[model samples]
Target: MLLNGLKVVEFASYIAAPGAAGILADWGAQVIKVERPGGDAMRHVFADAKSELSGNPTFEMDNRGKRSVVLDISKPRGREALARLAAKADVFLTNVRASSLKKSGLDEPTLRKANPRLIYAMVTGYGLEGTEAETPGFDVTAFWARAGVAMMTTPKGHDPFLLRTGVGDHTTSLATVSAILAAVYEREHTGVGRLVQTSLLATGVYTVGSDLAVQLRFGRLASNKPRTAPFDPVANFYRSADDRWFVVNPRGGAVDWPVLTKVAGRPELTEDERFRTSRSRKDNSALLVAELDAAFGAMAFDEIARRLNEADLAWAPAQTPAEVAADPQLRAAGALVEVDDGSGRAHLSPAAPAVFPGLDPGVLPPCPALGRDTRKVLEEAGFSAADIEAMYDEGAAA
Candidate 1:
């Protein structure tokens, strides 16, 4: 594996930081997840939801293949144990607030002072230096809402909706992973570690950067329109005869207009004055969309798919979760893999995003039970048996 022998000590909960660490673990890093006594709150994310079960795929996806060590960092002993872990770790990852980290003596200065070569990767809702640096933020609030993604994504005149779970966190996870790897490379030359920081808000802004860039440059942006009334009729979703929806993206404008019209069985319409040119189409996009909708609604999904293919029009079906799960392309690409639950049961889970050409990403191990590796991790950190016992007795270690 590319990151073989790399050691990461993760002090984070929920998705962002832990998700980044999970990717490092997939690439062959030994990751030790430092959890509170009751473990990450994500452990109970599905507790009150439908399909309640002892095992949670949500928690597993971000924590797989990592060892969990329970510690109450508010306690002096627990803070001491974490400091010891950071002293030996090649990388220290955390999503804990900057103020809390500083108060607990786990800030970058303290950790980097002990291990100058450590890569300190910090994930936050806002950032480390702002007034809201210590403000608690979740992906939905910071990433989606505060970052303008929610407003930008909501259709004009429609109420805002919640983002899908962990979408922003996972996106930020990719960013953090990239930053950590860069810092790791830099450390090889500088012989010193660096503080790499990323935030959900920042990641969200970047995710919607294309539109945001336009808004910034032009000082204005058109509100997001409904699919049926998009800025470009060629870039919209339409339903087939059987109610299967698919989107077309005629990005080449004039070149694709004819092809798209032909695919919709309306080649004659392309010659019409109101729809002949891109400008005219945009001016009357709603009417064009209505015409395409009627045409597509009269064709079966297979016929529409075949016609689109024949015309070389760019399009994709709006797949459901079930359809996505059965997609052959995803299966062949290793987008998902079977993971053991440690109790001998195996279930399919998402694989790391990147694939190394010559290395196996490795089978994902089960998410550890809370405090599962507390004793072992402490021992490996050079704590004596007596010391470990005393910490446990003091409720500092579990």
Candidate 2:
């Protein structure tokens, strides 16, 4: 409830921008989500030719605890309503392409003229100024592919793979949220709002910043190798006798090398000339990995875990999604939450990332049905009941 009085008017669909607004909503902002008549396409992501699905967790994750208003912005009436909402809102968030926004008179200049205190936040694919400024882009295309994240992450010889769903969008969402908060803070002193912007491409570049820094400095970079052929044998994954895969990353330097060898019951390997130093181990990583693989393959995960812990080495099991869901650590850290659906049913969902020490963001409300708050929002925006009805009748509002 930290943002209890904050009002965010969100004119975005899909993940990144909406996700930033969703976090604001979770923190008790009154978020009004504007959608087209058909609703956000995310609402039907799980649909098939046979039947539309009953539940959409993907949409719910980024849209819960917000009000939905369907508006056909192409219509003057709907655009006027949105402008009215912006005049009163503390923040206006959108991912709509620049050209369309300008054509509809919903651009930053127009909105800010009516409300100088409005924090206009925009999320884009490339950026606000570029040849592809208006290009349609998803996180996969903009963040993963065009930003070089996919290229650097994929194994050298294997075909590039897709990122897990919402990975890049959620990252960009966090960035957008941070920028919005910074602008909000500045507005307090200046009494003027500013245009805050983030893009999937920029966020992706920052995500791999360390690697990109190396590429910039060296003018070249090493490709990601397969797990079995990593650059660091000490920081590699192996399977145990029980077939549980786990990764180990000992501390930097050669201090833990001999300790690892002894822990694997291959103490004699500590003196092996080929594996004596860090450089030697990396140069002969394949051979060292094969040796460790054989040793780990002979032990159950429990034994391996015990030995690794006793040796003070850093390691963790490579668990599946199901395992992660049941992980006690996730709950202990408050990463998981139960949201109250309208029917009073509590369904598990991920909590917003940050945790304020003293304030508790209470139980989150369910995602609103499409156009659920259209009439209410319009009435609050000062439209008469007759005007609201006319808009609905004319298909300007739903």
Candidate 3:
């Protein structure tokens, strides 16, 4: 309820922009999603997939609790309607390309001119000012590949794999939300809104910033390796007797090596010459890893977990999706909530990351059907019934 009275008009599809607005809505903002006629491309994105589902969970995740309006912005009347919406919104959010936005008169300058106090937030694949500003980019190309994350994450000789859906977009959503809130705060003092922007590429770069920073200063980075032969053997995964994998992150400066050796029931190994110093252990990483593999493989997961905890080692099991879904810690932390899908069916849904103390993060409504609020939104924007009818009849509004 922190942003109870805030109004956001979102002109974006897919994940990034709408995801950001979804968080705003979670915090009690009234969000109006402006989609093109036939609705956002996301509506049909998974249509060809073979699955038994009543609704698109992906679409619902980013668009729930928001009103949807369909308008063909290419038409003058539709563009006029969008401008009217922007004029009354505290924030106008979009992921539409800069070129298209300008062409349709929905760019920052135009919208800000209409409402000086509006926060004009733009999400893009690249950025607003560049040769590729208008270039269409999805999270795969811009966020993963172009940002160097794909190359960095790919094994030394393996083909780069695509990221899971919305990973980058969701990350960028957090960045956009932070920027929007800051801009909102600034507007209180300046009495004017500003153009705030972020890009998938930029967000990706920041996500891998520590790795990229090392590469930038050192001129090169260690090649990606298989999990079994990671650069730091102490920071690696091992399988238990039960065949469950878990990761260990030993403390820096060789502080945890002796403790971990004892926990693995191989304290004698600490006296070995090849594993005495940090540099020596790294030099004999393969041998050290082999020993660790055998040691962990001999113990059941429960025993390994108990020993790791007893030794105060930082480690966690590599949980599967099913395991994650049943994690009591996640539930206690409010990572998921039950939401009604408008069919009187309550489904478990992901909750926004932020937690405001003393405030209930209210349940979200289901994603609206295509053009579900077109006429109502137009009416609220001060359009007369006759005007709304004419716009619909002229193929401008749906």
- TM-score per candidate: 0.97, 0.97, 0.97
lDDT of 1 by residue, 1-398 (tens): 77889999999999999999999987789999999988899998877887635678899988888999999998999999999999999999999988789999999999988999999999999998868987889999999999999999999999999999999999999999999999999989999999999999899999999999999999999999998778888889999999999998876648888888888888899899999988999899899989999999999999999988887778899999999988888867878877778887778888887766776555568888888999999999999999999999999999
- Root-mean-square deviation (CA) per prediction: 1.3, 1.4, 1.2
lDDT of 3 at 311: 88
Q: State each model's CA lDDT, in order.
A: 0.91, 0.92, 0.91
- Model 1, residue 170: displacement in angstroms? 0.7
Model 2 misplaced regions, further than 4 Å? 49-53
lDDT by residue for model 2 (1-398), tens: 78989999999999999999998998889999999989998998887636554678889989999999999998999999999999999999999998899999999999999999999999999998978988887899999999999999998999999988899999999999999999999999999999999999999999999999999999999989888878998899999999999999989998898889987889988889988888888899899999999999999999999999999899999999999999999977889778877788988898888888787656679999999999999999999999999899889999
RMSD of 2: 1.4
lDDT score, candidate 3, position 33: 96
lDDT tens readout by residue for model 3, 290-383 = 9999998999999999999998999999999899988988867878877779987878888888676687665567888999999999999999
User: Clashing pairs in model 1?
Assistant: none
Q: Please report, as a residue range, the 10-residue window in candidate 2 with the lowest summed lDDT.
A: 46-55
lDDT of 2 at 22: 90
Q: Which 10 residues in a row give candidate 3 its minimum summed lDDT?
A: 355-364
**lDDT of the structure predicted as candidate 1:** 0.91
Q: What TM-score does model 2 achieve against the real structure?
A: 0.97
